[model samples]
Target: MKLTESNALARVAAYCSKAERCEYDVRKKLLGWELTEEEQQRIIERLRKEKFLDERRFVQSFVKDKIRFNKWGKAKISFELRKKKIPADIINECLGELDESELDESLRKILETKNKSIKAQNDYERKTKLIRFALSRGFSMDQVLKTLTGIIGNTDEEYF
Candidate 1:
């Protein structure tokens, strides 16, 4: 199947109109349209020239919505963008845009989710459970310990 330049531009225009998309995603779509490698590059370059292929914009939007709606951690979100063939430097730039407080809150929300599922009644057991959960959710031990200690240890009543 051959892809004409006009067809490719129209299709990309329609796609970008629906939502912000990264160049990698748009390139994949172009390939699906059976565009040749040169054709794909041409379309991508055109899109970039038109400001529809902004990488930083894609990164910020992706970071914002994933954290806000998907409740994803920096680790998970970084892993995902890396899978998309995004550059490591850009991924760091994107992750860096999130404030430390925002990261902690996202971690807190993850801890809450994990804690709610465990059957442990003792504070010790509960803390252990949270450590495992947050760690599995890709939080660092340091952050996990800090958040669990801060959120769960605010009370004096013995849970055991």
Candidate 2:
């Protein structure tokens, strides 16, 4: 079925209204509809004007969702936003909204749960595995080590 510009615009508007949408998402959807560049731009402009497509809003919602529901770390969230073609300033602004203490607490909670599930050979091995796991999860290596140190208790040997 062929969609006229008006029809496409309406469809895209409806799509954006359903949830927070970045310009990248809307552009991809319009492109899939076989809209020309001009048509796509028109629809995108209208969506932006109508408050349907907002990068800031999208970034905020994305960060909140990934952190609260997915338990993703700042690095992962930033990477995903970049993949969405969000501007660096907006990404930084949204990331700034996340409180450091809150993030650390969240990481601590996740680490505690992960630690319970893993059975390592010794304190060193456990700390090593935990650090690796947190790093894989996109957490800062330094922060993870610090939290691990607090949770696992300090030993004579250094674990980095």
Give the Å shift of residue 17 in candidate 1.
2.4
What is the model-wide C-alpha lDDT for candidate 2? 0.86
True-structure RMSD, every candidate: 3.7, 1.5
Model 1 scores a TM of 0.85
Backbone clash pairs for candidate 2 read: none
* Residue 75 miss distance in model 1 (angstroms): 1.2
Compose the digit string of candidate 2's lDDT tens values, residues 66-160. Answer: 87878788998999899989999999988988888877888899999999999998888888888888887779987887788788877334554
* Index of the highest-TM-score prediction: 2
Off by over 4 Å in 2: 155-157
